[model samples]
Structure formats: C-alpha cells, structure tokens
Target: MHWRQKVDYWLETLGDEDPLKIDLLKNLSNEKLMEDSFYKDLAFGTGGIRSVMGPGSNRLNVYTVRKSALGLAQYILDQDDDAKTRGVVIAYDSRHLSQEFALEAAKTIGRQGVQVYLFDELRPTPLLSFAVRHLNAYAGIIITASHNPPAYNGIKMYGQDGAQLPPAAVDSMVGYLEQIESELLIEAADEKQLKKSGLLRYIGEKVDLAYIQALRTIQLDKKAQPKDLYIVFTALHGTATKPVKKAFSALGFNDVIFVKEQSFPDGNFSTVKSPNPEDAAAFDMAIQYGKESNSDILLATDPDADRLGVAVKNDLNEYVLLTGNQMGAILIQYMLEQKKLAGNLPEDGCIIKTIVTTELASAIATNYGIKTIDTLTGFKFIAEKINEFKQFNSHTFLFGYEESYGFLIGDFVRDKDAIQAAVFISEAAAYYKNQGKSLYKILTGLFEKFGYYKEETRSIMLEGKNGAEQIERIMTSFRDEPPGTINSIPVIKIEDYFKRESLDTVTGEKAEINLPKSDVLKYKLEDGSSICIRPSGTEPKCKFYFAVKGKTAESANERLSELVKAVFNSTCDLALHSI
Candidate 1:
C-alpha cells in the first residue's frame, strides 16, 4: 500500500471518540503533512521509540503508545513465566501526557497479566533504571524524549540488567511490534481492578532513598568539604529537581542556589529555547544565577536527568560551559587521582568511551595504567562492556561515558546518572577549592600535562521524509568515494563501521573492524587530526565529530576550524540540490 492508504486506513478505522480524529480531519488536505505522517511506522532504534507527538502512524499518540506496550508485553511473555512474574517498572518525566502514557503502558501490561510497578510521581529516568535492578524486574520503561523540544515525547525500554535493551533484544521487540494488526483496537486493563488483583503497585520515596544511598557510596572523599564551594543548579523544567536537591543537601553542600525559573516541571520548557544542556543557549539563565550568587560552578540536567551539563569560571571570570569531552576528561583525572591516593586504584581497571569521544580521556587513563575501551556511540554499548567485564573478569569497570553528556558511575545504575555526576563534580570542585585552586586551573593543568587536546561537533537537522532521504544520500556519497584529504591534510586511513573494515588509503590494505556494524565513517588525517561522520542515533540529524591535538590550545583551535570548514562545505554541496 502507498503512504496515502495508511493515512486513509487510520482515518476510517479510528473511533469517533478518539482524540486524534479531529486533528486528522483538519489536516487531510495538507498532502505533504499527510505524507510525512504516514510515510513509515516511526523508526524504533535500539534506544526505543521517539518522535513528534500528534495524530498519525508516525506520531506518538495514545494508540501508538498502546501498540508499543502491547508489543513489549508479548515480548515479555515470550521469555518465560518467571519473566512475567518479575514484571516491569514504569516511570515518566514531566512531559505533556507523560503520566497518561505511563498509565497506558501499565494498563496494557496489566491486561496481559504481567506485574507492573509504576512510580507514584514524576522521577528522573535514572531512577527508572535503578528500580529495575533494585526490584529484579524483567524490564523497565520511561516516558521521555530526553532533551528534545516540547513537541516531542517517547518511551525508552531497558532490559533486566537495567540498561537500555541491546540490539538483539530490540530486534526481537521490533519483530513483535510489526505483527500487531490494529493499534487503535487494543484495550487496556482497568486501573482500579489492576490494583485489586495485585498486578499493579506504586513506588515512591523508598526507592528514591535507596538510589540516593547508592549514590553516596560513589563519593570518593568523605572528608572533602563542599561548604565553601557555592554552586548553581537547574533541572531545565524536567524531573531532576527533587532527587538532585536531596543528593546535594545530603552531601552538605549548603550554599547552593537552584535556578528558580527553570526548576519547575513544565513540559513547555518556557525558560529556554532548547532543553538540551549541550546547547549553550540553555545555560543563559543558569549563567545569570551563577553571576549573581558568585557561584563557583553551574550544573544542568536534561528532563530525564540521565545527562549532565556543567559550566565553570574561566580565567576571565566569565562562566564557560564545558563540552562533554572536557568534563569526561576532568572526571577521569579526578577519579583516578582520588583512587590512587586511597590505594584502591585497581591494577586491572578499564575506562570505556565511544568512538567519537575524545582520545584525551584515554590518554589520562593510560597515565594511570588503566586500559581504555572504545565502543560504538551509545550508552548501551558501554553497559554491554560493563556486563562483559563482570562475566569474564577481564577487567574491573572504573568509568563509562559518551561524548553526548551521558555518563555512568558506581554501576548502581546501568545508564547515565547526572545525579552521580553532580555529586562527584561538587566533591571535585570543593576538593580543589580547599587547596586554593579553581576547577579552571585543574583543567589547564591537565592540558599542560597531556598536550592540548580539543574536539568539536557539527550537525544538520533534516526533518520529514525528504530530509531523511537526503541524509542517506550524503552518507552514501561519503562512503562510496572517501575523501582523499580534508583541508589539505592527507586521509591516511578510512574506518567504515558498516563494512566492518578499515582501508589504508595509501597502501590499499583492508583490515577487519571487530565492533558490530553501524552506518558510521571515520577518517584519520595525516596531521594527527581525526574526523568522524554518522547519523544521529536518536534524532533525525547527521553529525560530524572533529578532534585535534596540538602543543597549545590556539593551534588546536585553528586546526579544528580548518577541518570543520572542509567537512561542512563539502556536505552542503551534497545537500544543495536535494534540499
């Protein structure tokens, strides 16, 4: 059937009582809108489903949410009777319809006779992950879209291990999801009766307290005083306000100011242009708060609170937001320093990072005799390695982080924990302040000790069907005819993750890449610069990652500029005709 037929089927089959009916009726004449809405079933990646919330096959409405829940229920049942008995933990952020969606999933699973433990209120996504492990549940689901704009919302699936579902599991779930014949006709169990049958339970402060206790264990220096380190924090209108506040206060950080305007759980995220901490614009209000309070540092977490963004005072006393790579490098140094001092630095420990993340983190780990492992760009891959380490005893897991602000520590939670990061960052800040030094000085010291390393990212957002096709074209063009040189620097080798092989541009030699296949391409420049390009895993954008190391920061920045222009200019040339 054509895309038009899909839209027509939805229009005809939808009940008059369905809320999506009116929206579909009003947009019928908008051919482009209809096409985009019905062009495909929303792409369900390994991270689970995310898309704009509206009334279409591609939109995330109650019917679509029910479809996903029904599929999950079937997948859970297929595992074993014990799997169904172990149940799923459900939580939601502050997004519009988040609670509604959560309840819908719970009801759907309950109808299938699977146990459900739903959060009593909005909570950070990390808490959802923790609940799965803490309760020994079979699976977990959190209703969130992370840092996306207000118009979007999603559901993320986690496995029994408390990590996002691995690729094979996702593939199975997708198979189950594809077999559903009618999303609208599916019925959910009555919430009241689900409770009476003991199939549904609500979780609250008890779990929160347990998670905080687990967090406290990761505090490297109990004697480190945070009283002198004034800090500013903002949840950016998501779900971190309650727990982060509790963690900070519990740790004795008394002189902290919460950004009042953005602390509320508003789905609109009215205080900023975008909710993402990676975007510097989100820090404007936090910066204002930092300046007024003369704060030493600023911290912001996304809605689900799995990712953290930090800003600190530079030499000029202007607050500067640290990139994910910069913060990761700092944490690596600080964690190792404290571990070595305490004499618990394991001789066989390892640090895990994504392929696109900075090698500076690896350099810092190497200095401590800790091996660094590189995986594809996702926290699940990092979690996979954590599981592997435990199984094989190959190496002790020390830390795991990706370049996109996602981090994991303590292993209490399988995914990123901004709460943990906020605590450890506070400890690091206070530890340095006690020595009469600032975090800025420590960052510079790292650069001085391990050469100047810098990295930058550029992305292009292509929305709707045409935009997605254009992204494929751009990727294919780069893969088929690899760039010989980027900005007058020779392309020494090309790593094609999809092909699972590396080609030496000069020698015409091919070597196998051991990692799983992904649609990613990386180039090694002769001048010690690196360039990687891949489509965003969770968004409709193509991202370019550039990294360069130099004797000084100025040289690194200049070299980075040239490499970025070379890639950006070339990509634009490819998109000009299609776009």
Candidate 2:
C-alpha cells in the first residue's frame, strides 16, 4: 500500500477515539504530517520501543501500547502454561501518559485472561525488575523513556528473570507484534472483580522496603562513618529524589542537600537540555547546590533512576564531573581494595562490563584477582550473566556497569540501580574521608596504579527512516572492510560480533567468538588502544567508543586524542566501502 493509503487506514480506524488522531485526520490534506505519521511503525530496537507521543503508527499512544501488549500476551501464552498464570508485572515512571500507558497494557493483557500486578503509583525501573521476581511473574513492563524529553515516552519489556528480554525472545515478540492490525478490543474487569478472581494485585510499600534493605547490605565499610562529608543530590526531575535521599539518610550520611528545583517529577525537565546524566548539563542544579553547601560530592540520577552521574571537589575545590567509565572504574577499585582489606573478598567472584565500556574496569578487576566478563551492550546482557552465574553456582556477581552511567552493585534488582549506587558511593566516600583522603585523591591514586587508562564516546544521531538505513550501511561498510590501521597504529585484530567472527590481521587466521550475534565491530591496535562501533539501542544514533592507555594521564589524553581524530577522519571514507 502507498503511505497515503496507510495514513487513511489509520485515520479511519482510530479517528473516533483519539483526539490527536482526529486532529491529525483533519490535517491529512497536509502532506508532511501524513508522511510523518504513516512513514512507518516506530522502530523497535533491542531496547524494546520508544517514540514521540502521537496518534499514528509511528508514535506511542493508547493504540500502540495495546497492540504491543496484545502481541506480548500472544507470545507469552505460546511459551508455556506457567507463563499464562504468572502473567506480567507493570510499573511506570514519571512521564506524561505513563500511568495511562501502563494501565492500557494491563487491560489489554487482562483481555487474554492473563494476571497482572500493577504498582499503585510511579516507581523506578529497578523496582519493576525486583517485583517480577518477588511475584514470580512471567514477564514485566516498565513505562518510561529513561531520560528522554517530555514529548516522548516508551515501553520496555522484561523477561521472567527480571532483565530486559533477550534478543531471541524480542525477535519472537516482534514477529507476533507485526501481526497486530489494531488494538485489542479489551474487556477489562474492575479492581473489585480482578481482586475477587485473584488475577490482579496492587503492590507498593512492601516491595519498596525490601528493595531498600537489599541495597543496605552491600556497604564496603560500615564502620567508616564521616561526620562532615557534606553531599548534594539531584534526581533531574524524575522518580528517584525521594528514594535516593532516603537511602542516604538510612546510611547515616548526616549532611545531604537536594536540588529543590529539579527534585520533583517534572515532565518538562525544564532545567536542562535533557535528563541524561551522561551530559554535564544534567548536573547543573546539583553542582550549584553542591557549591552552596560546600559539598564534598555531587550526585544525579536520570529519569527512571537507573543511571547515576557523579561530581566531586578537585584540588582547587571546583566540582569536576566524572564520566560513567571513570565512575565505574573508581567504584570497582574502591570495592575490591576494601573487600580484600576487610577479608571478605570472594575467591570465585567476577565483575561484568559491556564490550564498549572503558578497559580500566577490566584492569581493576584483574588486579583484584577477580575475572571480568564482557557482554554486548545493554544491562540485559549483564543481567543474563548474573542469572547464568546463579543457575550454575559458578561465580558470585560483584558488579555490572555500562558506559552510560548504569551500574549495579548487588543482585537485589537485576537491572542498574542508582538508589543502590548512591548508597555504595556514600559509603565509599565516608571510608576515604575517615582516612583523611578525598574521593578525588583516591581517584588520582587509581590512575597512578592502573597506568592511566582513559576513554571517551561520541554519538552521531541520524534522525528518521533514512537515518536508520544510513546507519545500517555504515555498519556494513566497516564489517566488510575495516581500516588497516588507525592513526598509524597497525590493526592487530578485528572482532566482528555480528558474524561471531574474529580475525587476525597479521596471520590471516579466523576463529569463532562464542557469543550471541550482535551488530557491533571492535578493532584492537598494536599500541594497546581500541575502537568500537555500534548502533545505539534506544536512539537514532551510532556510537564510536575510543579507549587508550599510557604511562601517565597526560600521555593517555594525547593518545586518546589521536585515536579519536583517526576514527573521525575515516568516517566518510569508510562509508564508501559499503556495497
């Protein structure tokens, strides 16, 4: 069908119920709106689905949410009988129409006679991960866009193990989702009817208490209480301020300040460019508050509170923001060194990180005599490793993190938990302060010990459908013919994860990489430098990650700078190699 025909079909089917659809139908004579709405279904990547809020096939609304839920219900029902009874747990973050979307999914799944446990109000994404296991639900759904702007929203699906659904499961779910022609004509039972039938339950408080208590158990140094290590925190206008503050107070951190302007659940995220902790702008309010309080540290969480961003006072007493890689490296070093000192370090424990994250974490893990496992991007892969360890009883999960400010210290919640991270960070700060050392000093000490491993990331966003195709082309170009050298450093090895193949440039030998297929490429340099290229799972962008090492921080910075320049210089020339 032509795009216009699809637009008319959408108008005829949904115009009556959705005001946005009605307004859009009225403007159908305009070509741009029709093209925008009917160009295609919103792209569902490995991160489930996210899109602008509108009344079209390409947007997220009541219709799209129901259709997706119905498809998930079909997939789950086909999986097993236990899956049918176990149903799904649903949670939402503080976003426009988030609550409505969560309930819509419940109703759609309920139409299939599947049970649901819905949170009474907004909660963090990690809570939903915990609820899935606590209730033994077959799957879970979290209605949040993470740190996206107000005009956008999303739906993330979790598997039975309380992690984001794996690739195979997502592929199967997408196969069924494609067959959904319209929203399910769901017949929902009232709360009373659902309760009487024992298929629907509302949960709160109990789960919150359990989650908080679990976070408390991972403290590295419980006795190192510092009296005056004043700290400032901000939630970036999302769902974490209250819980994070409570976690700090519970940990006995006496001087904590909240960024009042960005503390509440403001959908606009009015104070910053975006709510992503990866961006320095997200910490503006917290930084200001830190300066006022003479705080030793500053912390900020993204919308759903899964990712944490931190800042600390430097030698000149100026607040210096740390990248996710920097934070993860510091945390790992602190945890391992302290655990060994306390005589509690596990003999058979392991740390986990994504392939594209900084190498400093792996180096730190190696120094602690703990093995590090590298998974593909996304916390689901990290959670999958955690689950694998639990099933076999092979190794204990010490920590899991990504370069995007997502970190998990304990296994209480399968996904990243800033609430947990905040607690550990506070404890670590207190530990160092007790010894008359600042976190800043401790970080420099690690750089000295770890050989100054520095890394950086750059994302190039390509918007809309054409951008998507271009990204595919870009990846294909690199896979077929990778550069022989980067910045005059000979390429020693290349790993093409999509084909599960690794090649030795020097020997012309190839070997199978024992991992699931993913569209990512990594190149190792002769100088112990590396570069990784992968498409962003949640956004319309492709990412390039650069890692370099040197004897000193200044040399590491220069080496990293040369590597980044080489990658950018080859971008256009490399794309031309695609067929």
Strongest candidate by lDDT = 1
lDDT of 1 at 564: 83
Q: After superposition, how far is residue 508 of candidate 2 from its true place, in Å?
A: 0.8
> Which tens-of-lDDT digit does each residue in 1-579 have in candidate 1?
588888888889987777788899988999998888888887676467888999887889998999999999999999989999999999999999999999999999999999999999999988999999999999999999999999999999999999999888888988998999878788999999999999999999999999988988888999877888999999999999999989998888889899999999999999999999999999999999998999999999999999999999999999998999989988899999999999999999999999999999999999999999999988889999999999999999999998889888789899988998988888999998999888888889999999899999988899889889988998888887777877878899999999999999989999999998999999998988998889887788988899999999999989998878877665532232444
Instruction: Score candidate 2 by lDDT.
Output: 0.85
Q: Which stretches of candidate 2 lie over 4 Å from their true place?
A: 26-33, 184-198, 570-573, 576-579
Candidate 2, 1-579: lDDT as tens digits: 567877767666663777866778688787866777668876567668988888677888887888888888999889878899999999999899999999888877876878888899989998899889888899999999998788889999998999999988888988898777654243444656766777777889898887778777887777777577888888888999867876777778878888889898988888889999888888888887887778889999989999999999888989999889888888998899888998989999899999988888888898889999999999999999999999999999999999889999988788998888887887788788878888889888888987898889987887666777888998988887788878888999999999999999999999998889999999999999998899988888889999999999899999998888777765543563332
Model 1 misplacement above 4 A: 570-579
What's the TM-score of each model vs. the native?
0.98, 0.95
- How many backbone clashes does every candidate have? 0, 0
